[model samples]
Target: MDHVQHLIDLLRDDLTAGRYRVDLVDGLWGDAAAAALFRGQTEPAVRALDAGRASGTPSTPVESFARLFLLGQALPIGEVAAAFPRLRVAGAEELGLVVPAGGDAGRMRAALDLRPYSFVDTLGAGSWWVVSDLGEAVLGRALDKDHVLGIGGASTTLSGLMIPTPVDSVLDLGTGCGIQAMHASRHARRVVATDISQRALDIARLNARLNGIESIEFRHGSLFEPVAGERFDRIVSNPPFVITPRVDGVPLYEYRDGGLVGDALVERVVREAADHLTPGGIAQLLGNWEYRAAPPGSEEGGSDGLERVRSWVESGGAELDAWVVERERQDAPSYAETWIRDGGTRPGTPEFAALYGAWLDDFDARGVREVGFGYVLLRRPAEGARATASAAPTPAMARYERVAEAVGSNPAGLGAHLEACLAGHDWQAHRDDDALLASTLVYASDVTEERHYWPGHDDPVVMTLRQGGGFARTAPLDTALAAFVGACDGDLSVRALCAALAEVLGVDESLLVADLLPAVRALVSDAFLLPAG
Candidate 1:
């Protein structure tokens, strides 16, 4: 641990001394190459030792002690060694900086400038600070230092889609570096973050302070152990769902390994989520699941390669409204390699190959054909059915839209869209308007189709098209609705225009009045469209 800390400190010192420039274009080098490259230059003491031994001259104690330091930093990783090619070469340089094949001088220069390169570089001096502080608490002791983490893409994705209603209590299961707990603290009056790793708990606490967040309780326990009987209005987790073999004496990566067998971690987490949620509460999580491969043409019945996750909101019979998105999928070897690199393992090394084999063996033993990763959002409404448990879970009440273009850099745009979606209604068009260009009104659709149901018998329901049904494919609209759509030309209330339409139609005013009024109201609430009002 001290060796690792010393190595990080040396790297920081090198940056300060102009020994290397942080390049944004190039990301963090892997462990193997980094180790080999830094092997000589970063260890001046080792260099002085060899020089002194060859010259038969005694070296200074400062030089004598550098060997231990170098030994500490020697990670048995090929990637770290490979990373050395990217290091800023000082004197006589052979392979000065490694550039991709066919890369130009610009690529070489970019590799030399390590500033803007990796995610850690974006953190700047903050990264050094975080590493140092974390090192003091976790690595400095005989505890796990391999696990270093913070909010990245996965954290923010889960945070954004989580139902954000204020809640009395929140729990962040498998808190790791506590990014989720930090977000939960903003809305949850009480927030508790739990992790099996004590080192992770220390860093999580440090992060809470660094971000100026208070009132969060950080506990060292696996899963629900920290708060056994306490139910939360909201619970969220970005658990370690990576399925790895239970190797004896092997250090855990703390960030991604939950130590559960195969899909057990994810399954147990989801299955028990309802137990921890308060009535009318919600739980959102990000996890990985296994999907088995199926044979072809035999009814096409194989496991869909999907990483499925659900919120498991506590409700009676019809207990929850769950939403899941299958974000990405990977086969056994790909998944194994992805995680190994993520854990700082060097590719092609003995240890790396061994770890890779173990991961695959674990997968094969469990019959996991593919791994899926995705998000889950579950809500337990205050009033919902307690349907009988079935063999399989029912499909969720969900809608999908490709709104990537609409999601601006600003969060407000995304938040507003969600709010409007919850209302489930479109806007109402007045009856007297005809020219849409005349008004400042804008409209959105609650659903793709707008239904104009006739009262009394449910047999003949007229459907009106709001926009964009080209080529002689016209939808039916009653006179009153046509007037409402035309009046949407920019002015007039639904009531005011409906009254005028009633007078004009004059068949039986009460009939249209009773039938169409509720439908008109449904539009506004649904946010199918929004008027200036």
Candidate 2:
């Protein structure tokens, strides 16, 4: 362990001195290589790197490091030694990061994938070197069952969605590679990261040590098994929610497929999360839900994907608030093709065809017409607000919607925006319509309006209220509502704005207020409007 720590310190120093960063590496390889790398094709990147080396100039330390680890290319032992003068080849071998290639001491290959990851959050910009199992690009075949994943699209997505608010303790369920747990360590006093795979736990622990982060505690168990009877102020997970058929010859990749038929794994997480959250605590996760089709001539339709998630939360009996956003939906065939290809199976082959058939058969057996993939946010209510007589009147806020459109991008990420939106919801939840009307409100700074008029007409045909951030919501606006929103400059109360608009439109003030109150509440809840001082 001391040797490991010494090697990690040397590695960190070498990586920092070499300026091994995401942007610099991208610049060195150019856009084509970067794009090809994203598509899981390394030929372009390899060619670019080789060309740079063939330019008759010595490769820089950063370039050598990227070629070996980022692109999974073998490097000469001399070059590896130069890249890490402090650790050298012997130290890298001691760290299990590289090994002799074909019993040749002159050449070495990376045993694991280690690359620099940089990001900007509310706390500011920083980077870390993450190490994980070599992927298909390096292995040149399907991943092993216990393969651990490095930074990927889903990992970054969940990280960006995490609320960065300070907290006492956080639970990172299914903390593969410890990416989310490491991020949580930045804000929480302590973080408990649990995973069923010991291999994953080991790699995650190494990552924490490599980055000099000591606030995360690693545990091994599936789902809530490890953290039983324990609660956290915040929880985040990107679980193995992929739907796969339970049949022979179908490999259950422990990194993804959770050995569950359909989307039961995600449902189980939602159902069990309430038991592990403190009052007013929150759990954010990524999941997949099955959207089944209605049977022939049946009056009652099949289960809705979003509603199924709602049912899981309801069954928890915790009166938790849930906000589920189905980011995208894919049909049965498309979904099968995606996960099948993801497992390194190529099209136009017998093996691919067999897996595709298995997926279709499984979906058909369960009457699954489509699969909806999305983000879910669940919150346990505060103390004294449990499902008792005193709290019986306030309905558990459950928002389930399909937001397939692009949300506004935030440079600091969306976590802060989500935190504010939740606060807005809670603020409006306690106020009656009359109370809300009596309160003054201001349009959020990120909001703008657009109007489309007919070619030769004075009246506009279309109006939209657009939000620049926080899910980038756009709502259709009528003439009266548009005028009312325009007048909300923090100088007038909601009631005064409605009354003035009603007078201008020659409508009854009471009727107009009744008509606009619901929309007003929605706008406020979504952060398009805020309460004025």
Q: Candidate 1's error at 438, in angstroms?
A: 24
lDDT of each: 0.52, 0.89
Error of 2 at 524 (Å): 0.5
Residue-level lDDT tens digits of model 1 in 420-504:
5343321122221222222233344322446655687764467674422101113355657655655653366545565677888
lDDT per residue (tens digit) for residues 309-424 in model 2: 98899998788999999999999999999999888888999999999999999999889999999999999989755343334456777899988477787766778888888877
lDDT of 1: 0.52
Ten residues in a row with the worst lDDT in model 2?
384-393
TM-score of each: 0.53, 0.96
In Å, residue 317's CA in model 1 sits off its true spot by 7.3
